[model samples]
Structures are given as structure tokens and as C-alpha cells.
Target: MNRKVIITCALTGAGDTTGRSEHVPVTPQQIAESGIAAAKAGATVVHVHVRDPETGQGSRETAFYVEAVDRIRESGVDVIINTTAGMGGDLYLDPHDPTTFVEGTDLVSGVERLKHVEKVMPDICTLDCGSLNFGEGSLVYVSTPDMLREGAKRIQDLGVRCEMEIFDTGHLWFANTLVEEGLIDAPPLYQLCMDIPYGAPADSSLLASMVAQLPEGAHWASFALGRMQFPWVAQSVLLGGHVRVGLEDNLYLSKGVKATNAQLADRAKTIVEAMGSSVATPDEAREMLNLRPRS
Candidate 1:
């Protein structure tokens, strides 16, 4: 029964969703515009993942991040920026031999992954807690414990809040360990990711279980993919957590209806208000998340 829920709209994600939606922003300018639009539509925070302009695929280029973030910051919008440090751990293996790296593979050292986070210096950045079989392909996400420790330490030293992205129950376990080891600061923030194929399923009961495992007084948010996105808004608020929406997790405003990032954020705001809670403003969100603005 949380009264003030924070709405984080993930502007663009490192997924194969570019071809699926016309609204999925590819270039840096489009991504920045989408972030601003989502903020004006009632999102307190915007999660960003830059994409290749030509191929519309996920890109780990620091220049893309720089351009997008610079545009958003220069817009004078009062929204918290959260960049994704989850890019470089991708593992595309050969179908015949898993030992051999394939074309789409982009595995790098943990600190190497945060190259942009280090340079861009956003208010907040994500640290994916563990690995997963990314999708229905030979692709796997590899975020080992060592990687998590190093990334967590780096983000901490950078004076940026680390949003531990837990895809499954076990990832939550390791995330707690990071807290215990003092890698992440107190009242750590977490994003309980749900319904990414082969990860945590998007079930209410499972979400409750994960909520029960959260650190005391920790700030957290949860999201589901596709059609379950809207429902999870109510689900998360009812469970005393925050909510996330936007093109990163889902692309539809309704069945047969393509959605812009702002539309999804507006819909999330409507749902939260309907649930008898108000969406937090960016300044309020920063206060709740212990985030400070950068100059």
C-alpha cells in the first residue's frame, strides 16, 4: 500500500525489439527525445540503452551514450537519468560448439562494461545481478559474481547509485551478498525483472516471493514484459514497490496498437493513480533513491 510510487520509463533497451516497433528509438537524438517525452508524460526516471542508428540493434558505443545523455541533460528536463551497464556481458556461442564465441558475442571484463557509466557519470546506473539465457537463441548473458563485484565497486566509487537488476530469485541472493560485502551502499536499489523468457516468470506469487527477500527499507521497482506490463503496475504498487514502463519492457499501448514511450508512461501514471497512489516527481524520486544531481 505505498502512497507515492516512482515510475521509471525505460526509454530504449538492448533487445531485438527495434524491428518490432517503429517507436523504438534507434539514434541518439530519438532516444533523448523519447526520454524527455516520457518524463513529461509522468515518468520520474528514464532508463536508457542506446542502439545502433543503422542496424537498430543494441550498441555499446560510448559515443552513442554520450550524445543521447548530453541531449537529455541539455533539455532542462527534471528527470533522473539511469543508464544501463548491462551491455557488454552478452555471450553468443556457436550452436555446434558452445565453447566457441559467435558473431553477436560481446563479452568484456566487468569494468570494461561500465566504460560509458564511468565516462557519462549518470545519476544512476544498473548492475545486472547475474547471467541468463538471454532469449530463444544461442545467446546467453554472462554476469558472473566476480563481474558483479567489480562493477558494483566501480559504480560505488563513481558516486553513482547502482540499481541491481535481479532477473531470478538467485540473482537476488547474490545482490544481497553485494550489499553485505559493502560493495553497494546502504538502502540499495533493486529492479526485480520479470517475464524475460527463461528468467523470472511474470507471476504475482513469484513477485511476492522476491519482495519478501528484499533488504529492509530498500528502494525497489518491478516490471513485466509485453501485455503483463500494465498489470504489473498495480501488482507492484499493491506489493509496496515501484513500477517501470516504456519501450524497453513493452511496446504496445493495447492490442493492435503501437505505442510511443510517452504513451506507455502516461498509461502507467493512470494505472498508479487509479490504484490510489501518486507517481513521484523526479526530485522526490531522487530523495527516495538517495540520488544527487550532477553538475
Candidate 2:
């Protein structure tokens, strides 16, 4: 395909992957540096998820966002900042009594989740479309209909482009509902996340089916976890969508070889170019996704 594909590098996620790889940036400074490197390596957008510096767990603190955004801006790299508003919804339930919340639970209202976004005012933000069993456990990532509506309205009000994260077909359905209800703006964005357990599996046909279900004029991207990350880059482009890659979804550039955020971004850029598609610049991405210019 001869198109300008926007490459997004997810710097760090909230998952407990710090123990698995030392490359996962835990502090705000590290996250900023990693994102800057990715941008330098050809990523147009950097998806951010700050972690607690002390504990290495995911944090929704505005201070973390402030520091990370500040550092990235101060570095003068032209990359779109896309922060995660998907935090504060993790609900690890008690195995015996599902009604009772467990130690890992961090459930909160959708409004609370956007507090960081409201403060930082990034170029783009994520809105997970619906609830799902996140992993192989009782941890249901809760984002109810009411919560989604409230979140979508708030993200719109903030003037941040909302990238609707679709982990399953139902999530995609509700995302369409949000768009139909006018909660989402024109050129709505979607991210098809696959193979996270108990949700949609990593299958190209399923991706095509979901792509067919998307609303008209919608811009979308798709990704699978772990080893499937690079392949999904080609898969997404072949299907006329963008691609995402980083340490957030996968830890290795190759088997038994660890990868950095910049390395993953470089590899993704090479893949996109090898497939006869040029990678979009930050400004081009902004234009294509209808995002506001970086301020």
C-alpha cells in the first residue's frame, strides 16, 4: 500500500511487566526519554502510561503526566502525545466472593480517570470502549455505558482526539453507539487490540470483520500482543489501517533479545517502508487523524 501510515509507540503500560524487562520505563523522566527516542526513530505518536517511580506500578497522577509531558516538550521532539485514560478501572475481584474487591482493584468513575487528561491536555487520549476480562483472572476492566458516555463527552469537551480502544466486538459496537450519539467527533479513531485473553483472539479475519463494522470515515489501527506485534503491523497496513508497537505490548525485538521503545519504533518504521508505505510525520498524523496541532 502506498499510504502515509501513522506509527504510535506506546512508551510504558500499567501492566506488571517491570519484573519481566528492565527496559520498561517506570519513572516519568524515563518515560519521557523513551518517548522522545521513539519519536526520533520515526514514531508520529507516543502513547503514554506513567508508572509509580517507587513501586513501578501504573499511576494516574497528574504530576507524572506533567513531568513526562514537560520533558517531551522541552526536548523539542515533534511527536503527538497520547495519554492513557484507561487507568483507575482495573477491578481484581475476590475469587470466592466476586462482589468483594481485592487488593489489586483500582475501580473509579470515568470522570476520575480523565483527571490527568484534563490537567495535561495532551494531543490525544484513549477511551476504552467497554468492560472486559482483561487477562486470565477475575480482573474485569470496567468501563460501563454511562461511564463511557461521560468519558467521551469530557474528552470531546477537552478538545482531545479520543482513540476508542476496542478489545472485542462488543466494545466496537458500543463505540459505534458513542459515535452515533454524537459523543465522538468527526474522523473518529479506533484501536483494535487483540489476544489479551478472554477477549478477541489474534485473527486477521476477525480484524477484517471488525474493520467492516467500523463507521464511515473512521481512522483505525490494530495490534496483537507479544510475538504477533510486528506481524500485526503488516496486517494492519494491508487492511488499510495504521500500526502501533512498543514495550507496552511486547518486550522483545527478537527471541531472547530485549527491545527498547526506540528499537521497536525503528523496526515498525522499517516494516511500513518495506511494505511500500511511507510513515506519517507528527503533523501529517495530526492532519489525518483530525487532531489539533501541538500547542
Cα lDDT for residue 155, candidate 2: 97
**Candidate 2's residue-wise lDDT over 1-295, tens digit each?**
4388999999989989999999999999999999999999989999999999999999988999999998998998889999999999988999899889989888899999999998889999999999998778788899999999999999999999999999999999999999999999999999999988878999999999999999989999998999999999999999999999999999999999999999999999999999999999988888888888666
* TM-score of every candidate: 0.98, 0.98
Q: After TM-score superposition, what is the CA distance of residue 255 in candidate 2 from its true location, in Å?
A: 0.6
Best by lDDT: 2
- TM-score for candidate 2, please give it: 0.98
lDDT of 1 by residue, 1-295 (tens): 8899999999989788888998999999999999999999999999999999989999999999999999999999988999999988888988899889989788898899899998889989999999998879898999999988988999999999999999999999999999989999867999999999889999999999999998898998999999999999999999999999999999899999999999999999999999899999888887788886657
Weakest 10 consecutive residues, lDDT, candidate 2? Answer: 286-295
Model 2 regions more than 4 Å off: none
Question: How does residue 16 of candidate 2 score in lDDT?
Answer: 90
